[model samples]
Target: MDCIHLTGIRSYGYTGYLPEEQILGQWFEVDVKLWLDLSSSGETDAIEDTVDYRSIISLVQDSVKTSKFALVERLTASIADSILALSDRVTQVQVILSKPAAPIPDFSGKISIDIIKKR
Candidate 1:
């Protein structure tokens, strides 16, 4: 299998258990890996023969930015499911979501969740 990696996808979303987090919103970063066979695309060099990354980008943005969820797990699942639904070529997907400004009092690093889904 081949992988198409998209990293540092940032969006503003309302997702958290805390009321303030929902009200104020936060910046979420996403990294996605789409696994598929790329032989046809490599041979043909045709857009239709491969995954359209722009469409994937749009789908991710819409999935993350348009709705509110209480858990990053849900957000990640939504992304994975949407990607799987959008393309039959995708045999597997990995989504990583990070919240840089997580509500933890002392932590400086981001809080993130990673999920892998297979078709």
Candidate 2:
């Protein structure tokens, strides 16, 4: 299978266990790898032949920016499910979500979750 990779999608969202986190939304980064067969799209060179990534971006944006969750695990699952709903051509999906500004004391790097789902 072929894949489409989207990385470094940044959005502001209120999703955390802490009260301050919910009150003051933080920046989140999302990465996705969508697996599908691109042979037809490669041959035809038509938009209709392949997944529309702009639409996928819209879905991710809405999911991240418009919803609140206590865990990025749930958020990641939601993103994978939503992407799967886009087309049957997608056989599998992987989502990586990160909170770079996580409120952990003395943390130097991003805190993140990664999940993979198959249809």
Candidate 3:
């Protein structure tokens, strides 16, 4: 299947195990890959023939900004599910959520979770 890759989506959200994280919020980055047939779009060269990625980006941003999930795993799954709900043409989706500001002490590395959903 063909894939649409959307990367570096940044948003401020309040999702974390720590109390301060939920209250103060932090920046989150999301990367999504959508798998679907691109033949029709390639043939017709029309916007309607393919998924509008603006919706996906907006959804990802919204999910991160408004969600209260404590687990990044859950958040990634939710994103995959939500994206799958957006279009019937999408056969599969991969979501990679990155938490660059994790609350772990004495840690300078980032944390990320990747999940894939298939229709």
Residue-by-residue lDDT tens digits, candidate 1, 1-119: 99999999998888888888789988999999999999999999998988999999889888878878889889899999999999999999999999988989888999889999999
List model 3 lDDT by residue over 1-119, tens digit each. 89999999999998888888889999999999999999999999998999999999999999999999888898899999999999998999999999997889899999999998899
- lDDT per residue for candidate 2 within 20-115, as digits (tens), equals 888898999999999999999999999898899888888888898987888878888999999998878889999999999899889879988999
Clashing pairs in 3: none
| Model 2 pairs in collision | none
Instruction: List the candidates ranked by TM-score, beginning with the highest.
Output: 3, 1, 2
The lDDT values for all models are: 0.92, 0.90, 0.94
TM-score between candidate 2 and the true structure: 0.96
Show the colliding residue pairs in model 1: none
**Model 3 segments more than 4 A misplaced:** none
Comparison by TM-score, 1 against 2, better one? 1
What TM-scores do the predictions have?
0.97, 0.96, 0.98
